[model samples]
Target: MSAVASVVSLVELLRGNPGSCRWTGGLSPVDLARAERELGTPLPPSYRCFLAEVGSCEVDGTDFLGVYRTPAMGDTLLGTVSGTLDARTDPRFPPDLLLIQYDGMGGLVCLDLSRRDRAGEAPVVVWDPGSADRGGPERLAADFGSYALRQCTQALTRGG
Candidate 1:
């Protein structure tokens, strides 16, 4: 499925279990534009679509970092993308790495904007602060959507 389709399905699943799913919120096209403008860079197309569709949400307690939808724009809590990049102490961190999600710990999932994979999308990689010196990121997905598919599916079906 396309990235937007994938997100739609996930959101649908969340809707079915609102009592358990945690939705931080979602973002509008304007919000996406502002975030890109503020960061001085554009986010990947797939991720932008996801934000437009899924925003911020948690699946079975697994929160996928997303833009804040309500009390909405200009909120500092919605600054996950740039915040983590600023706080990173990794000297070898790439110049175009965009922090996309937090693993609820000290680690993050980032998109490599500087380099695109065979599919023309930036590769998603994991940054574990404790292992920053390991010389490279642990590649998570070919793109943000792929990461979502791999992770969200696992998260939803783990015990089903």
Candidate 2:
């Protein structure tokens, strides 16, 4: 499937099975632009589409970070833009990594911006902060579309 189609499928799954997933609705172009400005970079096209189709969401209580629909709805530690800003304060955090989720294991799921493709897609990777043996971020997917597909499949497999 194409990137946009993959994201559309993911959004449909998230919306169709409300028992296992909850979504915060999509963002406006203005909000997306604001988020990009705040983050000081252009978001990947597939990821931007996902955020515009499903701003923020959780599957079985595991939140996928994105721009919140409104300022009042944002959590400093969970909203994509805000969370990334806060994480940037850490000297150890790489400047090109954009936080997308907490791995529940002292690891960060992020978009590796430094490895962005010519099409503007970044690979999803997991960085284990507490693992001395993990020399660098472990790639999770080729792009946000693939990552979203994996998340949707996992949620469905869990009886969503």
Candidate 3:
């Protein structure tokens, strides 16, 4: 199956199952485009398809966290809390990359997704898989999905 198809199927499964965290729609197309322009890179294909077909939704697992898609622009807004892990020590973390794109063809691309936080002292690294350097998009997607699921489970149990 195509990457986009796989993601859509996954969404369907999540939508049908109450055990998994639910997703609420996210940023609008204008916002997604703005983000893309600001970032100077296109979003991943699976993410694009996700935005188009699934749109965005608040995940039931994690309060207020979600993956949003923009059908018009074919972009995705991954709204989740940022987690930090020192790549040097964390074996599970991938290398630092601004954005990672996975085409479901066993191909992964990493883009620089660093931006200055509100404090502006240091840049915030969104996804860093434990490698000494940045890893592929598939890796980031997998890691983020895993983290989201774990957080969702916790949130559901806490009734958050």
Candidate 4:
């Protein structure tokens, strides 16, 4: 199966169990453009597909950040836009990285925007705030699609 299809199918399965996932809905092209404009760089192709297909979501208590909604309406709006902006305030956080998830252990899962493959996909990496200098962020996946596939598969495996 194609990467996008696999990710979408897995997410759908994960969402079948009520309360297992909370999705913010798919994002419009306009919304994507706005996010890209604000971020000052185009997001990776796989990530763009994810935002368009699933937007932001919390699956089995794990957040997979995406484009934020306007007038949030109490939706928390703690997705990619907000998370990246918030992290950028820290001197230690690199200015070009995009935050994708908070690993719940003082570590953040982010896209290494500076490093992209020929397919325009960025590496997914885990940055531990408690130990930034301890060998730097650990790479989690080659791209968002792989990372998300692993997450969805794990969530389903755990019976979520």
In candidate 1, stretches whose alpha carbon ends up further than 4 angstroms from where it belongs are 69-74, 77-79, 88-92, 117-120, 129-133
Give the Cα lDDT of each candidate.
0.69, 0.81, 0.40, 0.79
Writing each residue's lDDT as its tens digit, candidate 1 over 1-160 gives: 7554565676677777765567655677778888888666877777776777767777765667776633545465364554645745566556577787776766767887777755446788877655557877777777877677667667777635
Supply the TM-score for candidate 1: 0.77
Q: lDDT for model 2, on a 0 to 1 scale? A: 0.81
In terms of lDDT, which candidate is stronger, 1 or 2?
A: 2
TM-score of 3: 0.42
lDDT of 3 by residue, 1-160 (tens): 5444555665664566555545554456776565456444555454444444444443443333223444753543443211111122445443334332332343323332343223221221233242335452233223223333344345555664
Candidate order by decreasing TM-score: 2, 4, 1, 3
Better of 1 and 3 by TM-score: 1
TM-score of each: 0.77, 0.88, 0.42, 0.85
The per-candidate count of clashes, in order, stands at 0, 0, 21, 0
Please tell me which model should have the higher lDDT, number 1 or number 3: 1
Q: What does candidate 2 score on TM?
A: 0.88
The candidate that wins on lDDT is 2
lDDT of 4 at 139: 88
Candidate 4 local Cα displacement, residue 78, angstroms: 4.6
> Residue 23 deviation, candidate 2, in Å?
0.6
